[model samples]
Target chain A: MTSHPPAGTPSGIVLEHVTKRFGRTEVLTDISAVLPPGRIYGLLGANGVGKTTLMSLVCNHTFRSGGTVLIDGEDPAENPVVLGRTCFIREDQPYNDAFKVRDVLSAVSWFYPDWDAALAERLADRFHLPHRTTCKKLSRGQRSALAIVISLASRAAYTFLDEPYLGLDPSARGIFYDELLLAYSEHPRTIVMSTHLIDEAAGLLEEVLVLHEGRIVLRADADEARTSAFVARGLDSAVTALVGHREVLSERRLGSILSVTVRGARTADDESRARAANIALEAASLQELVAAIGIGGIGGVDTESFTTQRTSR
Target chain B: MTYARRSLRLYLANRSYVTLIPGGILVIMLAMSLVIGVAIGMATEFPLSAQIQEGMRENNGGAVYSIPGFLISLGALAVNRNFAMALAFGSTRRHFWLGTLMGFGLTSGATAASAVVLLALEKATNHWFFGVYAFDVAALGKGDYVLTFASVFVLAVLSLALGALFGTAYRAFGTKGALLTGLAAAVLVVAVTLLSASNKEIVGSWLGALGVWAAVVVAAIAAAISIAGSYAANRLARL
Candidate 1:
C-alpha cells in the first residue's frame, strides 16, 4: 500500500559518533554521519560489517555502547513522540504466532497513525498472501512480502529495512523494486535499506555508505562513487607511466600487458594522454568499485597501490 | 491514535487466545456438569441432598476451575514474541507495559465476573443439583455471594499481574536467568515452609488473621508487582 508521507517535512536521522559493542566485540565504531531527509540511502557493506547493527542503533532497537543517536534531532530511546514516527522491519522480525495475515495488518494499522489499509490490502493481493494464513504458517518468501507490505503501508517518516529481499524470487524482487520506487514517489520519506544485491539495487540509491570492519571507509553520491576511480590497460611501461603517483585500487599483469584500476577524476586531458600512451581507459561501475573496495584490505596486498578515502562524517 | 490506545489494541490482539481458552473451558464445564447433574438426579432421587452432603464433606466444587485461565494469561504475556514486534512497529516501552497492564485488567475482570456468576448459580441451585461446587470455595465464598465475588476478582487480577511479572522477569533475564530466579524462589519457599513448621500454632493464627483481609492484601501486592514488572521490562527489554 502506498500513500503520501505526513503533512510536513520529515526530519532526518543524525548519528554523531555512534558506537555499538556486544561484550568485547565492537560492531560499529565511531560512526558519524547525517542521513538527510527524504532520500534513499544504500547502507552497503559485506556481511558482518555492522549494516544491520547500524540500522538497529539508529532506531534504538538495542542500546548503544557509546555515542549520540538523534532521530529528528531528539533521543529516541523510549521516547514515544519520536519513535511513533519511525518503523524498523528486521529480516528476522517475529510476529505473533497466533496472528493471521489479516491480523497483522490490523495490528499495524492500529499502531501506525498513517497506516493505509487499502494499500495493505492491495499489497496482500499482489503478493498472493492468503489473509487467513497464520503468520507461523507463512513460507519464507511470503514472510518477506508481508514485511514489505507493512513497511510500505505504515508510511513511517523514517523507515529501515534490513535485507528486505532475503527470500524473494527474481520476479518478486522486481515487484519489490517497482513497488518501492512507486511508494517513494507517491509518499517521499527517508528510506535506509541494507542488502547484498548491490548491482540489482545500485540504480535505486541516491547515495551510498560503505562500512568495512566496523568502520565507514567510504561515503559519496552513488554516481560520484562509481566515477571516483577508473581502470587503464596498456603495455607495462605505458600503463605504469600513466599511473604514476595516482592511487592504484587494484592491478593485474598478463604477459606484456598491464591492467590497473586507479583512483581520481578522469579528465579529458588524462583520457587523451592515456590514448597517446596506447592505454585503454574505462570507468569502473559502482558494483566494481564496491567489489574492489571490499577486496582491498585483505593481507594488504590487494590495495598496495590504492589510497582509500573516507569522505563523510 | 494515542500510544496507549494503539498499544492496548496490540496487547489485546496478541492475547486474544486468553478469551478463547476460557470460553471453551466454560462451555465444556457446563456440559459436563449438566450430564453429571442429570445422572445424580436419577440415581439418588434427591440430587440437592446429595450435593449438600458432598459439599459438607469436601467444602469445594468447581471454584478453582479458572486456575488454568490465570496460567494461560501469564504464559501469554510472559513469552509473547509479539512484544518485540510491537517495538519494531513503533510502540514505546511505556505504551507496551501500560497496555499490557490494561489488557490483563480488563480480561481478568471479565473472567472474575464469570466466576462470580457461576458461584451464585451453584449456591442458588444448591450446588447445581449434582453437589458440584465448581465456583464455591470456602475461603472465597464462605456462603457469602458478595465476599466470594470480591475474593475471586482480587485473585484473578493478582494472577494476571503475577503472570506479567513472571513474563517480564523471563524477558529481562532470558532462560538462564529465569532458571536461576526459579531456583532461588524454590529455595526460599522451602526455607519458609521449614521455619514455619516448628511454629505451626503461630503460623495458623497469623493465617487466620490474614484470611480476613486476604483480598485487599493480594490486590495491593499485585498492583505493586505489576508496576515494578513494567518498570523492569521497560529498562531491560532488548529487541
Candidate 2:
C-alpha cells in the first residue's frame, strides 16, 4: 500500500553540514551524520542541546536554515514519497483537541500505508488508554501512551521518537520497551529515539549520537561508547598525579575524594598505578559520557580549564 | 491512499463537524424562519396567502448565512488544529494544501447543492405552500436556482479561505500575530468600504455594469489569493 517503493539501495539519513537557526540563535550547527537503515540509533543530549531540533530537521518537520538533509538519498521537504516513509512524533505532539483517543488512532492509520490497526488496539488495551476520551482530557501518561501507539504502529521506514517516555511509569515504560523491541524485530525499521533516561534506553540503542551545543560531539557504537571514556575515583592529589595532564571530560568532588571521568580507555600501566594509589578505574556508562560531554565541553572546547575550575571548587 | 487523499481523510475525520453540524444548523435556521413567517402571516390583517406572499417579497431570510459562517469557523479550526498533526504524521506541505483545497471544494459544493435543492423545493411548493420564503430570500438569488447555487458556493469558498488565512497567521506567528492580521483585514475592509462610499457614483456605475458574475469572479480571486497566502504561512510555521 506504500505510495512509493522502498529504496533499492537505501543510504538511510545522510545529513551534511546541516544547520538550524531560530532568529539570531543557531540551534544546530554543522551537524553531519549518516544514519544507515535498519538500526536503532540513540540521539543522546542534554536539554536544549539540539537533539529534538536535529530530529525535526531530518524529518523536514521544520525547514533547515542551511545544509543538505537527505533521507534515502532524497530531499524530504514537501516530497510525499519521502515523507510517506518517515514519521517524527514530538514530545508534546499536538492532537486535535476535539479528537478522541480512538479518533486520533483512526485518523493516523489512514496516513501510514503499513499502519497496524490490530497492534494499535492491543497497545491501547495494554496501556489502559480510554478509547473514548478526548485527547485534551487525557492525562500526560495517557498522552504518552497514545504517542507510543502511533509511533510503533506506523511501521514507517524511518521513525523519530523525541522523548517518547515523558510521563510513563516504570511498568508502562517496560511495556513500551517490550512492544518497541517486538515491533522492531518483526518489521526492522530505522528508529532514532532521543531520551534523557540514557541508561534505561541504553540497551535498545545500537549506535549513539551525543549532541553538545548544537554539535555532535560524540558518535560511536553503543558498546564502543561505553568504553570511550573511563571514570577514576580516588583522592584529588593521587588521581591528578597519576592522570598526568590527560583529557578530563568531567570531575566531581565530595569533600576530599575526587571522581573524574577522563577520555580514552584506561591503559594497563594506568590501571596498575590506579590500583597502587587506591584509585578505582571503571568504564564510563553512556549516561555519564553524555553528561560529561555536555558539562565539560567537547568538540575542541577548553575542557582543561573547565576541569581545573570544577576540581578547585 | 495518495498523500492528498490521506490529508482529505484527515480533514474529514470528524464527520460531525464537517457535514452534520452545518446541515443541522441550516435545518434549524429554516425551521425558525418558517415559524417567524407563520407568526407574521397570522398577525396580518390581509388574507393569509396575500399577506404571506407580500411578507416574503418584502423580507429576505438571514438563515442561510449560518452555513457559510459555520464553514468559516471549521476552516480556521482545521488549520489551527490539524496542520501540525498532519506534518508529524508525514504529510508533505503540498499534499496538505491539495487535500485541504479538495476538502473545501467538497464542503462548499455540497452545501451549495443543498441550498439549490431547498430553493427548488421552496419554489415548487410556492414558498412552503404559503410563501414562507425560507430559501426564496432575495439574497439567495430570489429563487433563481443557478444564481443561488453559484452565490452560495462562492461565499462558502470565500469564508473557508478567509478562515484558513487567519489560522495560518496564527500558526506562522503567535496570538498577537493572528490578532494583528485580523485587525489589518478589518481595517482593509473598512477602508475599501469607505473609499467605495466616497466614490459611490463611479464605483456604483462600475459595479452595476459588471453585474453578478463580476462579484463572483472577485470573490473567487480573493479566495485564490487567500489560499496562496495560507500556503506561504504554512511554510513559515514551525512545529
> What digit string (tens of lDDT, one per residue) describes model 1 on residues A1-313?
1122343345587777789999899998887777879999998878899998998887777889998877777778888888888889889888887789999999999888789888888888888888999988999989989999999899998888888888889988998899899999999989999988888998899988887777677788888788888988999998888778777766779999998777777889889999798899999876767666676642222121224542211
Question: Number of clashes in every candidate structure?
Answer: 9, 0
The DockQ figures for the candidates are: 0.75, 0.85
Q: What TM-score results for chain B in every one of the models?
A: 0.75, 0.89
Clashing residue pairs in candidate 1 are A1-A119, A32-A313, A248-A305, B51-B131, B61-B133, B62-B133, B62-B134, B63-B134, B78-B167
Estimate the TM-score of every prediction: 0.85, 0.91
Judging by lDDT against the true structure, name the best candidate. 2
Question: Interface RMSD, all models, one decimal each?
Answer: 1.0, 0.8
> Model 1, retained fraction of real contacts?
0.89
Residue pairs in collision within model 2: none
Docking class for candidate 2: high
